[model samples]
Target chain A: MNTELKLQALLDGALDAREIREIEAILAQDIQSAALMQELKWMKAAVAGNEAEVKLPETREFYWSKIERGIAAEAKQAAAAPAERAWWLRFIYPATGLAAMVAVMFVVSGGRTTDGADTESVPEDVNAISFRSEAEAMSVVYVADENGTFNPVGQETKNEPEADK
Target chain B: MPQPPDFTTTLDVQLVAFSQAGDMIAFEELVARHRDKIYARAFSMMRNEEDAIDLSQEAWVKAWQRLKQFQGDSSFATWMTRIVINLCLDQLRRQKRTRAESIEQLDEELGGVERQMPVVASNPTEGLERAELRKRIDKAMTQLSYEHRTVLILHEFEEMEYKQIAKVMNCSIGTVMSRLFYARRRLASLLQSLKKEQQS
Candidate 1:
């Protein structure tokens, strides 16, 4: 710190013994520093205990009324917070269940079929073609022997009459 | 409901305890006690009656909401003062952003302006009555920038140490000291000028 601020610290009683001695020594030697220190002391003394008395203009009841209203508003807001959160939770619970159901269905079906359309697959060594329809819930399979003659081996239809089961 | 307990005779600490227990009557008593000091602190910082009143009211509401957190480290009045001071600082910062600072104010904030000011050799406040001294000080305070005025109010009026002022003002200790030095010097100069104006 410079001499001026050191003088200030001295006036505020902020300086330790060593710093006080140092500032005192400076004060004895420098007229300007001493003068500045004196001015600071005067200002401090004048300002202390001299704050202008100010009163809240409103009556006690009037002022307290506003504070009461503010507290009520804040309390209301705090209470509403949990209900606001529950509103979001209402959507979240069903959305979570729907997601879990979709996950399970994907696992059970092995994979998803596009557009619920019929799908046909032929295995490499079986020499057979299989047809499946997710929408109709039906399956048909045709097998071919060494002569390449195709014959129906299995057929299942969800819409078939019970006598045809 | 049964008649509410009499709070007129209750001490501040008891009132605070009751307030903590969700007693609005006790909290109201606390407000009735220290409302002036709190409003004064805000006005001294904000320099506007409307803002001071509004902020002081806001401080009370905040105090009530946060009463559970009051640990009684400081006197209830002091704690309330701190709340109001913080609120005023926030309001001042917001106001500062929307306004332009004068060149003199900028110089004051940047430091070294007090050096150019010549020292007032005679004590400007010497032989003044208590009320007159207060009036002069208040007038002189109005002449300072908010930063300078705030530092003075914090250091001198609030009786806060340099470190405490730094913490409250959200600045470095060096900045606090520098601002304080400038404020004191400028205040001396202004008081001297007021004295001369009166003499003439």
Candidate 2:
């Protein structure tokens, strides 16, 4: 290790017995090293002694009241999240069910009935089911026909089907 | 209701028990007891009054939340101090990430300009009165980089060992030692310069 690091380790009492003896030998013979060690000791003492013990600028009531408000707010937030999640679930659960129902409808209608009649073939007939998302400034349009046929359109052509409908 | 017991006179352990038992007043008493110390620790690390107040309050809220986990292995004040320190450390890390590094931070890899200064034999704080010494120390502390000031506060003021500081700082013990060494050296240099300015 570097000499400075060794000296610092010696001061911090981080050295093992062997390293201590070696540093001790150096300190005993080297007057300069000994003085440097003393300086370091003085520096440590001055810092440790004179560290400022600061007080809160606010009053006791003021400080504790802020903390009190924080705790109450955190508790309120913690309690609110689950309720909010449940509220979201109220919408999400039914939305998910609706999506599942729509998927099932698509699957059931994909085949011909035993009576040789077409099922409610909305998948093939409902071409370009365009959805405009209220949250985002964008619209999504999917091209599908009544026969469960699909045709993807480019961005420029995407508006034509919606306008056509 | 019957008169509540004098919580101000109640010991920390009993107060912790009361708080954990869902007594808000008891938790308020605990906050009153150690708010300054916790605030001081945050101020020492963050060196900003606004951040210190905000983070200290947040720590108290966290302490209240985690009061059930307080097994009393340490004093309530000590436990609370740890929370504030961790909050300050986290805030500092966030601030560090957002802002560009300061000149001192850039020089930290090479131990900074203070490392090249000669050691002054005279004690920088020897002749100053106690208040003045404290004032100078606090001012000088602001001159250090965040890492340097943190290590110094942890090792010198908090009296943590290199190993403990390393764990808290998430670095090896060698880094802690080196930082502590540089911090002290830089502080000594700053103090001497302050003393010289006072003389002239």
Candidate 3:
């Protein structure tokens, strides 16, 4: 803090005893500092109890009526808050449930699947083709030799059609 | 069919108690008693009758809503004054954002303008009447930027300490001291000018 602010703190009784002694010493030695301090005192005193008195221009009933209406409006708003939340919550809960159900179905379905579709990969020396179906729960792999004739190498079926069981 | 309590003679504490118990009449009495002082504080800070009245009324409504939070740590009037002060500060901050500041006001906020001002050798308020002093102070306060004027009002008229003013104004204590110094110096300068005008 500067000397001027120190003088202000001194006037406001904000400084400790040591700082007070220091500021007082400065004030005693410096005429300008002392004059500034006096001016600060005058300003403080002039403003302290001299606040311009202002009255609420409205009558008591008139003023309190608006306050009364305000309190009522606030109370009404407070009371309506929970209902407002519940109104949104009504949609939120069902929407959340629907979203969770859709996510679960997506997870169980293992994304997109093709039924009766075959995928083939041909190597430099051999040609092999593979078939899988999540809908039918089955997989088949076929390999072809240099003669261009294909033969099944492996087959697996988790579920097969039942005639009368 | 029960008669309402006579709130006119009730003490503020008792009235506060009644108000907390959901008695609007008691709260109304409290408002009637302290409304002027609260409005006066708002006016001093806002410097407009319309804004002061609206803000004071808002403060009262807020006080009622937050009555349960009132623990009676300070007098009801002081507590009410603080609510109004905070409201005024909010309003002032909003107003400050919308308006552009002049270079002089910006410089004042940046600090150290007071150091350049020459000290007024004579006391300007020495022989002034109380009402006239108040009038002069109010007029001078209108000339200051909101920050400087607020610091003066909080420290001097509100009797707040530098720390308290800092807390209320949401600034550092160092800033509080600096602004206060500037405010007092500038106030002294303005009062001197007013005195000179009167003399001339």
Candidate 4:
């Protein structure tokens, strides 16, 4: 250790026997270090003997009242936090379950024939023909009008008047 | 629940257990029991009464929050003390951020000009009564920089070892030793000056 650290260790009684002997020999040879040792010893003794014991200036009740206020406030916040979370969860839990149920119903009931019949054969006089396009992944519904022409529900036929005109 | 023994006479461990179980009364008792020591520790580090009081109370609030985490490794007071010390350190750090840097602070970091002075030969406290000595020490403590005062308080007043102080201060053992060495030397110098002032 360096000289200052060695001296500190010596004062702290932290030195092993060999280090203690070394420091002692140095102290005997060095007047400055010896004086430092004397000063440090006196200082340590005085401080250890007379460390101040200060009490809080406020009355005990007054001081504790502040802490009690703090605790109460924190406890209230703590209690309120869980309640607020539970309120949100009350709404969120059913919403999430509803979404899951809708997804499951969609998965179970999607794209199935309701009756036990082949879907390819159209009824002889049926006016609406629904076409499923496998490549584009879309279903198109076409209705046959009085002229026996099929028209997609949303698209205008040739005889329709343009609204903007 | 066996009517929960009077909190005033309850031991710290019992009080802590009750506190963990959400008993505010037990925590209030703990606060009353150790408030002075905790406040004194904060005051020793912060050297400001308001800051000490705030920090000590904050430490108690923290203890209440973390009561369940108290695994009985150390005494509740010691654990509480560590919390207060941490708060004081954080308070000091915040204050330090706004503090102006000065040549004097630099000098203190480098052990100051006092490190070169001839060592005082006589015991400065030799002729004083115990009460007077304590008063003088308290006055001298106020004059020290936070780092020096903190190391002295930890070593002398708190009776902490260098390693423990190092851990608390979050510095190396060598830094603790150097700080303690400088603190003692500075305390000795201050006491000598105080003695002279008294004589004059």
Query: Which numbered prediction scores highest in DockQ against the true structure?
Result: 3
How far out, in Å, is residue B117 in model 3? 0.8
**In candidate 3 chain A, what residue range of length 10 has the lowest lDDT sum?**
A112-121
The digit string of per-residue lDDT tens for model 4 on B1-200 reads 57755777788898888889988888888888899999999988888899999999899988888888999998988889889988898889789889896887778877645677668888889978889999999999888788889888888877889899999888888878877887788888888898888889
Regarding lDDT, does 1 or 2 come out ahead?
Answer: 1
lDDT of 4 by residue, A80-144 (tens): 99878998898998999999998888789874544533244345778888765444445667888
**Model 2's TM-score against the true structure:** 0.76
Where does candidate 4 clash, by residue pair? none
Candidate No. with top lDDT:
1
Runs off by more than 4 Å, candidate 3: A91-165, B1-3
TM-score of each: 0.79, 0.76, 0.82, 0.74
- Candidate 1 ranges beyond 4 A from true positions: A86-165
When 2 and 4 are scored with lDDT, the better candidate is 4
- Residue B16 lDDT, candidate 4, scale 0-100: 88
**Better model by DockQ, 1 or 2?**
1
The digit string of per-residue lDDT tens for model 1 on B27-143 reads: 999999999999999999999999999999999999999999999999999999999999999999999999998899889888999999998999998899988988999989988
Taking the tens digit of each residue's C-alpha lDDT, what string does model 2 give over A43-67?
7878886779888999988888888
The CAPRI category of model 2 is: acceptable
Interface RMSD of each: 0.8, 1.5, 1.0, 1.2
Per-residue lDDT for A108-137 in model 1, tens only?
A: 989865675888888777788878877776
